[model samples]
Target: MTSSFHFRPMVLMASSLALLAGCTSSPRTPAPVEDRTTMGRSSTPTATPAAEAPKPLPGSENAGKPGYYTVQRGDTLTRIGLDNGQGWRDLARWNNLTNPDLIEVGQVLRVSPPGGAVETSGVVVRPIASSGPSSSVTTQDNAGNKEPTKESASKPNANANAQAMQFIWPSQGKLISKFDANNKGIEIAGKKGDPVLAAESGKVAYVGESLRGYGKLILIKHNGYLTAYGHNDKFSVKEDQLVTKGQKIAEMGNTDADAYKLKFEIRDTAGKALNPVTLLPQR
Candidate 1:
């Protein structure tokens, strides 16, 4: 009985050790896989979008005739008129514009007179015809009474200065040069910085240095008539501004000239050059 009890205790202890070894030898299951692919909420920056360009205005070119002008980007009323050689005020008046600065891009505006007709407001009176006393004509009426007919009749020469715009001296200076075949205008000598006046009431058409040999110039328009003042040192009036006769518009200078002077000109409604002396009042 004692030998059997010892053998049974040894068997029980071996079975307990086998169970513990099996538990340690078996591989442990891998821990739950971590979600390493997930990232933070913040992100990288991207490029910004670019701005769009302005659209171009549309129109056609018809020189010296009634036509339309398209208002383009960076275009003002004065700039449009200057480019077309039309006065800003005249353009505004012709288009019935109540506000000159309210022009918009892509807007069409009138640039000529209605029906392309030349405006004439002045009357030309003809000189009386001289006749000898014996050249009188007699007309006999139905009642047998003789009556003398009228001799001198006044008529207008439409081709002559019938609607010419009158002008005055642009500056109180000595006439240094007169208009000639070689020159389209006259030059008046004056001191530097002398006041330059407008020859007639009109709208400021152009004000810039675009024209060669005319430094710092200002162009004015009177109806169909156009006047130019050149070699100015300073401009008092801007483009599109209304100026009256004798108004100080600029300062005389020697820009593009050998001496200080003012270059003045008078152009017809069609841009033909005219003698300034004929239009200007006698000094």
Candidate 2:
């Protein structure tokens, strides 16, 4: 009876051990999977577009272009020709203008000589190549005959000796203004209808009120030099009229000036202005 009891207890313990092994071997629920791709969104940054700049106005370009010039307001044909290295007559001929005094703003003109076999003798009357102190007048009579005059006795000796054209005061007055970059000439205050003399002897190149800021203007060409007399009450001489030194060319007035005054200037062969005070004799 004691041996049977021990055997039975051993068999019961073996069965309990077998039951625990089987329970451990059975499958268990899997741990939840971790998501890595969508954790905190993308790390790269998004791009953005930039804005465009404004464009320039039409016809505003080509200011520095050669062989052509775009006319601005207040511009005259004479002024344009002087600015370029040509005579106003040549420009008129090149452009086939019936009236040299008429030109509109924004008109594109040919600054260079025209192509083809064209007569250029029209330019000989006022040649840019014949610039110097030598005075040679080719004045023609009504019969188309060349009239000769003696060398002007009024020409200053200093200027003649230096091979430069002599210049003189255009009117008797007090100098109210001076020359500058913007002010291309000087202003001399005088009485109304005061005599405005020719600074130098030459044929009148232009006479009109076509140019703005200048009233009843007169442009004279002396050898390679040129002079401008502005703000006149009345013009004593007409275009193409021959003028002598101290000769009355106009009557000074307050046409475009603040007072009764004459605006005078002296320009070189290239149409570059020289100080009138520097060229005019001592007052």
Candidate 3:
């Protein structure tokens, strides 16, 4: 019986060692974990940029005010007078400039007459008959002959009576383009050497290629308006020369244009470009 009891204890010890050996032979594996350091940041969107504003034009602050003009680069007294609807001589007299050609950039000049009243050299009168006289009592001279009326005695100034002026077509051709926000004038498509006529009676203000995009340009200064003829292959008029309505001023060509054309524009005294079609007569 003692031997059986000792054998029982030895069997229990063997079983305990076998369990420890099995535990040491194999270890449990841990589960895998995800990396979330930049999880939300990777899915985030970026902000969009804002749009830029348009740049203001030069001398825009003085727009709509006709009494003054700010001299820009490449400006001359004649060009300024043309833009302001006055003669160059008149501009010289108004500003009392000793040298009209000497003008600096950003210099302010008086565009309008002093006290806002234009000075005249001679008197203008209406005919007595046209004045609604009740009787036809003609004034006889000492020679017993009919005396000339005051209307015949004095001639009216052309520049003073320009509000009633009219305009005509500058060229005969198909209108390829029209005036818009991007285009300052209308384009008339024509063959090279086609006649470009003056839209109204005026004195030529500028004649040259100085103006960009307007090749061989001619700027005519009417009393209250200014007309432009651009992209001409040949010029028929010179600067400071007087031109009547329907007079040939230039020849259509593809100077700055892609094709043979005449670009015509009409501007006010303030140098603001206007749609020429509005002022031209209907075909």
Tell me the spans in candidate 1 whose CA falls farther than 4 Å from its real position. Answer: 1-114, 118-164
User: Clashes in each model (backbone N, CA, C under 3 Å)?
Assistant: 0, 0, 0
What is the C-alpha lDDT profile of model 3 across 133-235, one tens digit per residue? 4333467888899964543333334554344458889998999999998887899999999999998877886787755678888888775677888999999
lDDT of 2 by residue, 58-168 (tens): 334645565667888888788886565345776787777799777767767775566633222211232123435456556788899998655543443443312545667
Superior by lDDT: candidate 1 or candidate 2 = 1
Q: After superposing candidate 3 on the true structure, give the runs of residues whose Cα lies further than 4 Å from its correct spot.
A: 1-66, 73-102, 113-163
Sort the predicted structures by lDDT, highest score first: 3, 1, 2
TM agreement with the true structure for every prediction = 0.50, 0.56, 0.56
What is the lDDT, from 0 to 100, of the residue 62 in candidate 1? Answer: 37
Please list the C-alpha lDDT of all candidates, in the order they appear: 0.76, 0.74, 0.76
> Local error of candidate 2 at 212, Å?
1.8
- Residue 225 of model 1 has an lDDT of 72
- TM-score of model number 2: 0.56
**How well is each residue in 1-283 modelled by candidate 1, as lDDT tens digits?**
9899899989999999999999999998989986554555345655799889866532323322346777778887765665555666667888778998788766778766678776432223233343444445799999999998876543444654424455778998999899999888999999999999998777777787755677888988766577889999999999767787789999999888889999998876544678899888887
